[model samples]
Target: MTTRTQTLSQAGAQSGILPIIGAAVLGAFLLYAAGFAEASVLHDTAHDARHSIAFPCH
Candidate 1:
């Protein structure tokens, strides 16, 4: 019953919703980790990342 264009249109619309949900979940996890994680671990990870990116942490 469906035409090719209609089928592709439906698929395209469905695909966009997944990335929005994924970003929301990732954002929530980062927020929780930053707020509740041990200070030393968080600081170490951030320091390493900064150096890895060639950011001067001094």
Candidate 2:
């Protein structure tokens, strides 16, 4: 019973974690493809953006 509970908890943590991690990887790829590395200055490319694309943020 204890093992089953631990397994479920672990699965729940992984399910939530994987999406966050996958999104981070996708975002990083997009930023690099967009040429953030060569950018002299980062500004708002899109209006009302929740976060900047070039820099990591919540």
Candidate 3:
């Protein structure tokens, strides 16, 4: 039988893992879209975003 502390520790570990996994998935999707999506779509959107922050896209 698992003690209460053991159970709570396991739950805490799982809760921490879930957000890391979620962020990894989100990052992967963004990378895929940036690389594979049509330029007309990603380019204009990213370009304007960079300029808005005074980033030199040139």
Report the number of the highest-TM-score candidate.
Answer: 3
Who is ahead in lDDT, 1 or 3? 3
Worst 10 residues of 1 by lDDT: 31-40
> Superposing all C-alpha atoms, what RMSD in Å does each candidate have to the true structure?
5.7, 7.8, 5.8
Best-fitting candidate, measured by lDDT? 3
* TM-score, cand. 3: 0.39
Error of 3 at 57 (Å): 19
**lDDT, ranked from best to worst:** 3, 1, 2
Write down the lDDT of every candidate, Cα atoms only.
0.69, 0.58, 0.70
Q: How many backbone clashes does candidate 3 have?
A: 0
Supply the TM-score for candidate 1. 0.38
Give the Å shift of residue 17 in candidate 3: 1.5
- The candidate with the higher TM-score, 1 or 3, is 3
TM-score of each: 0.38, 0.36, 0.39
**What tens-digit string does per-residue lDDT give for candidate 3 at 1-58?**
5798899988887676778889999998885555445567675767666557654455
Candidate 2 backbone collisions, by pair: none
lDDT of 1 by residue, 1-58 (tens): 5798899989888787778889999998785555434567775667656556654454
Worst 10 residues of 3 by lDDT: 31-40
